[model samples]
Target: MNRFILSVSFSLALGLASALLPLSSAEAAGPRCLTDCTPRVGIVSAFGAEADILLAETTGRREHRIHGRRFTTGQLRGNRVVIVLSGVSMVNASMVTQQLLDHFRVERLVMSGIAGGIDRADHVGDVTVPDRWAMPMEVYWHAGAGLPSPCGVAGDLACLGLRLAVGEDGRPLPPFVPDGTDVPAGSWHLRQNHVLSRRTAPQGAFFFDYPVDAEMLAVAQGIEPPLQRCGPRATRADGSIDEALCVRQVPRLRVGGRGVSGTAFLANARYRDYLHHVLQARSFEMETAALAHVALANDVPYIAFRSLSDLAGGESFDAEAGALFTSGLAEANEAAVTLSFLEAWRRRPRR
Candidate 1:
């Protein structure tokens, strides 16, 4: 009887030990457990209106909630796809994209949305597929000295070799300089093989311009979807078209230019000109750069299709332009191009 009891106890102990063992890396990755082995392309948008259009087009979708965000997995244009919203800004975009990468077998990443037009040549409803994306809002806050005198002024106090700018209020304006530059006011400060100190260490600095996947850009360039020219006119509450708000020209597709992202909703023409001249950016939005940065870090191919919803405050700003007219047209154009790209990818021969 005692021998039987000992044998049972030993068996129980062994079972417990086996249960305590950690899972292997392959087992830990949830995708391995899924029955489907097909790799999925990730589709990200900033908000519901954009995502809704894609979701409607996707078939056989199964919804899954992770980290409080809804991800729909299915086929779009016959390509395996997983669609999710990246929220609205840089932080939200980066976080959701990383989460998607962590939980899914995302083969590639693509974003489709609306952006403020920065290029004078591009009109509202035009879809732009930029070759690169950059964050223009990343800056160093150089607290300028209160007085105009250079002495004791924050502008004169060079921290990390950047001079602060004076504000209109007679106080120091935080010097808003691009990341990874050592140039003082007018002259460039050249340093050869300089070691970085703790204070001079690179903070919030990135390559600034992150290029889209070359092959993906080529595929996008090849897509020739028919685009909408004029957005529907804004209507009064009674549903009559407001002729004053209608955009007259047919919107066209522009491929291979630069896109920029920032936290601000730019409305000033002067700042728009600065972005156009300095960065050569065609469109400005709030999310694409962050998504590009995340994708680049992961070595994942990334691309974005952005339709112009507004002029970023140019030529008599119409605050109601997006909601009243351009939003639907932009979303439709983006979806059309994205679907076409998927078809192109399907037909391309695999290496």
Candidate 2:
């Protein structure tokens, strides 16, 4: 047996191995697994819509289970392949990755999802297999202000209730632009690609928020955990990560228009240090780091597959972002097809 083959006792686990046994490039490509317990392969994504489509088409399933619910798990080529939606935020992502590992006992974890591109050279729809990623958690603060006055309050000030803003330097900036004034949309602090590159900054950065998948070697040694959270901290009203702020922040990174581009000029302590530490960091995602954690802990031969959903640099989720997301999915499907066929072909019983 290949060193990677896993032993599973779950009904779904059984189904997955059985379906995969007659593995061959051609056979694997034909259909996917039918049950959850039998799934030898595991895929994790943050986007539920993308996960649902991929699972159903690849595994050919109309219904499935997750967290003991009738929540659907899809298929691939008539074989059972478990698909999970880890939600949008990194915390949610970490939680989901841990949950899947516990429930599935998957032999291998394949993290397929979208990520932002960081360099101008990387246009919309470009695909990147990031050697690793950086993950960051939010540290929030609150501001004090007077309560709002009702409509009829004679002395009420219209701006009293407004939330004040601060910059990274921890100094306040003028609350809002003058009513009739306009400022140029100046050049965003864009930089060249430098993640894991030699020129990355060295200090003041927090420890790796997200680990690089390629560094599976480090994960097995117990020197690190599987999940690595990266990216900017959430800056919400009162300077805390409230529900609305949390939602806005998570999606912002996924679609990729903000954040420092390239490793050329990282200002975020966490980001600069991440680049310095994990020279292998290439792409960014919410789930793969968590997936890496579980796989390493379980001794599974794991591989994280990500299709670029947007350029990591810039500042907004635009039409280009949409193109990248769609294109990345297509590429991931193709790569999955290729991998399944190769594994199946190798597993076929010989005469």
TM-score of each: 0.71, 0.44
Cα-lDDT of candidate 2:
0.40
lDDT string, candidate 2, 303-341, tens digits: 454544544433455554443333333344324432443
lDDT of 1 by residue, 1-351 (tens): 999999999999998877766445444343331323458999998757768878999999999888678989999888899999887888888898888776778878998888988888987778899999876666543333222223455245343544333324744432233232322333211111122322234543325467899888888888888775433335567977655555567678899888988877777676677678755779998998888877765667899998888788566746445442543555666777778888997777676
Clashing pairs in 1: 144-172, 145-154, 229-250, 229-251
**RMSD, every candidate, angstroms:** 9.1, 20.2
**Candidate whose lDDT is highest:** 1
Model 2 stretches with alpha carbons more than 4 Å out = 1-39, 59-75, 133-280, 316-319, 322-351
Native-referenced Cα lDDT, model 1: 0.71
For each candidate, the alpha-carbon lDDT, in order, equals 0.71, 0.40
